[model samples]
Target chain A: MKDRKPLYLMTPALAWLTAFMVIPCLLILALAFFRRGLYGGIEYTFTLENLALVFDPLYAGIFLKSAAIAGLSALIAVIIGYAAAFAIAAAPSRRQPILLFFAVLPFWSNYLVRTYAWIVLLNREGLITGLARWLGYDAEMPRLLYTEGAVVVGLVYNYLPFVILACYAPLSRLNPEIAEASRDLGASSWTTFRRVVLPMTVPGIATGFVFVFVLSIGNFVTPALLGGGQFQMIGNLIYAQFLTANDWPFGAALSMVLIAIMMGLLTLQTFATERASGAKREES
Target chain B: MASLANPRLMLAILAAVFAFLYVPISVLVALSFNDGGLPTAWTGFSTRWYGELLHNRDIMSAAFNTLVVAVVSTVLATILGSLLAIGVEIRRRKGRFLETIIFAPMIIPDIVLAIALLSFFSLLNVTMGLHTVILSHVVFNLAFVCSVVRARLKTFDWSIVEASTDLGASTPVTLVRIVLPVMLPAVIAGALLAFTLSVDEFIIAFFTAGAGRDSITLPMQIFAMIRFGVTPEINALATIVMAVSVIALTLSQRLNRGGLPGQ
Candidate 1:
């Protein structure tokens, strides 16, 4: 078998990754420990001030808010997705793949476009407004496009397909006999679901939750567009710092914190997935 | 499980979920053809927005840049990614470290990677432009391409390679004459996926495209248009972008029967 030559062949991918991924990530890590320049460039002097600024009440508040909003979106998406996946799984096996494909099809499209779709629906002059007025309500309409609720809705809609995809896998792979056995053992449907099905699918739920949360937290577009200028998620803040504010050092610092949070959550998710899988193995 | 057999609830849920997913997209697509300036009003059907898109120089240039970036990045990513996948799959000794590092690009947050690449380029005095966007995009694009190709490789039969080798074919000759033909479909599928990602990618391009309208890509143009307030032009642009993605991914999935990446 080819050996050394193949390893050499992998060098290009490795080199590209090292140059663009590893090195850049390290550069940001280094930037986080440095001071911001007065003119929006980096200062060579090493300091913890940038990192410290990340924890300041103002920035920390933004971080917490981003996390909360992301959490809410993830939670909502999981519930909606779980229900949908459950329904799909219940369908005849022959039709399941097509159902699953449509469920996930929209997600593969442009992310920005999907978020913009909500803008068309929720903007003051958008469809919802037109519909509301046609229904004869003359009251002052609520602002819909640029709000926290709109952001959550956008995140949920954009990510629902993925949540369905994640949740559907375990559901489809589930052995119906296990559920039937539980049913024959006299457990209620809800009880069997809670104790048997839910436990079995905990890994999927965790995966979906983590996937949604991570993407939503670092998501700049949805909040920027749907939440409008008022909403500042971590992603938006980082964007502003780098582009508008031109505070590269501080932006790098904020990005580091964002990565740290993502990594932490991802690590926790891995543990959760493994534990659930371990339990499943025990059941087997 | 029992409750799921209830057709009424199942159908309702399915309808609701599809509506939630499809409504916004349909609305956007429908609005693109609306003659009225506002999204709510559809006085007449017109292709005016698409016509307006052609006349708009800023958007046209952005579209051109997007095409250039997507094509260049996808080509480079496909080549490197296909090689990497073949190499990784062929090797008997697959290191966990190598696997994890290769997969890291797919999982990393875009914002983080964007800033990281931005800082890395600025620090290295590497001028940020379409080239930088292509380079940064290839990082993730290659990972995706590798994944798709690797999935195909998993179901690949290795005995053919041994047979070809036993017949005294050289390594390169064997790969060219044997593996290439078989893996061609997956390679094309991977290239399609990479193209789709590069086209849709915004944040990475936003950061790396440098500060000027000259280097702006379609997503950047769309972003500027949206922030400047929605216009019929944006609806048109968004429609085109989404259509491109759907077409590319549908084709990719057709070739690769497994599933789309990140699924």
Candidate 2:
């Protein structure tokens, strides 16, 4: 009875997950191999055309563009977030919790609201344009909204706090003595950070980077609203295939590819984390 | 070491980052109160838009649907997740496969899950609605709740359970009398977090909600409104939604002082 307790306790959740998550994901994999019907329904016959179409130049270009945008957003988020985390870690210990709390507070709010906030600020009659006009010689307002920059900004804004939290974990846990030892060895601050602190914090950086990149690449909302329906990230393409275009097979194929990219990044992140911990163990 | 770097430089970075995080949100909140409700100029402060929100049937229905989904899903997730956490933690041999199964929902891209569930439902001929949205939301919500409960369980002492059994207390009685009290805070914390996530979750709900205006959630409504254009009513609605999530999450963080979900 004692041994069986654990099994019984876990059954409901396991059953729920298998019925909902696992089966659905596998169904998507199967759906990708089928053909689309003339009327937008799934055809019973199996075909690899959807997979081949994913690799075609037209769709492939969207994938590359999505990767580039996700990459750029990840890079900017890491830089800004790392700096913020570093500053928080350097603050007085008493103040650190309050600071970190406030830093992460906005992240818990409605993501659409946060994204909408950007639209309010970047639109033609937005605060930025208004500020520019107030401070300036009369000139035509630049098109700030409905651009690639707006999408990138939206992605970074929505995901930045997670990066800060990730980076701050390693930074906060870091032994200051390690940095002091480097400084005492006559290394400059820059050299100390690059060679000593940065290497140790690679796990955090990897986690943050992979997280932002994966989410950004699959993001449809930011591109749809901020890109003004003009920019077509892989997310937008997939959305069209499913909702508007009614190409379920193609959508599933694109999703499989997205999952592949995500798994690859996640595997890399795990390797980085393991290596970082192994290095720490050796150092001690 | 802290003295080695310019304190002023650190403060500047902190200031800049905080501004980046808060400025956009602050703008939305401020604009919600603007009488004219246009970004171009603020005529005066007014609560007219918020008043308008009350009279808007679409917004009201969506808000009610969101409430139904969030409450139902959070309850279901909390019970299942807490039990799973206890079971997983109690087992002496934890497999990597089991860990992956538990963690998958947290890391899986929202788009992937959204479409997967969408496809799965349609294939089964299950009519999608607020109920389907609730079902899908549970997939991720349970994962989050489990992790939180599991984090709390990490510091849990099994000796107490052993002692309770030694006293001839039955397992169910021990769980009810001993375990439940100790775990209540974390359980509630996890439920609050789940509620917030469900309320704000859009993509999955959007996909699984089928083609019906009645089942629309707050975030889906917000997304549709935002695409058309930002309006003063949306500003007011956004403010309310943000406030609810912020408050729930703050209470969650307070209870589960160990860490927030992602962190």
lDDT of 2 by residue, B163-205 (tens): 9999999988988887777777899999999999999999999
DockQ each candidate and list the results. 0.68, 0.72
The per-model lDDT (C-alpha) reads 0.89, 0.92
Recovered fraction of real interface contacts per model: 0.72, 0.74
RMSD of each: 2.6, 2.4
lDDT of 2 by residue, A1-284 (tens): 26568888899999999988999999999999999999999898999999999999999999999999999999999999999999999999999999999999999999899999999999988889889989984788779999999999999999999999999999999889989999999999999999988998989999999999999999999999999988799988988888999999999999999999999999999999999899889978
The per-candidate count of clashes, in order, stands at: 0, 0
Per-model TM-score on C-alpha atoms: 0.96, 0.97
Off by over 4 Å in 2: B1-3, B258-263
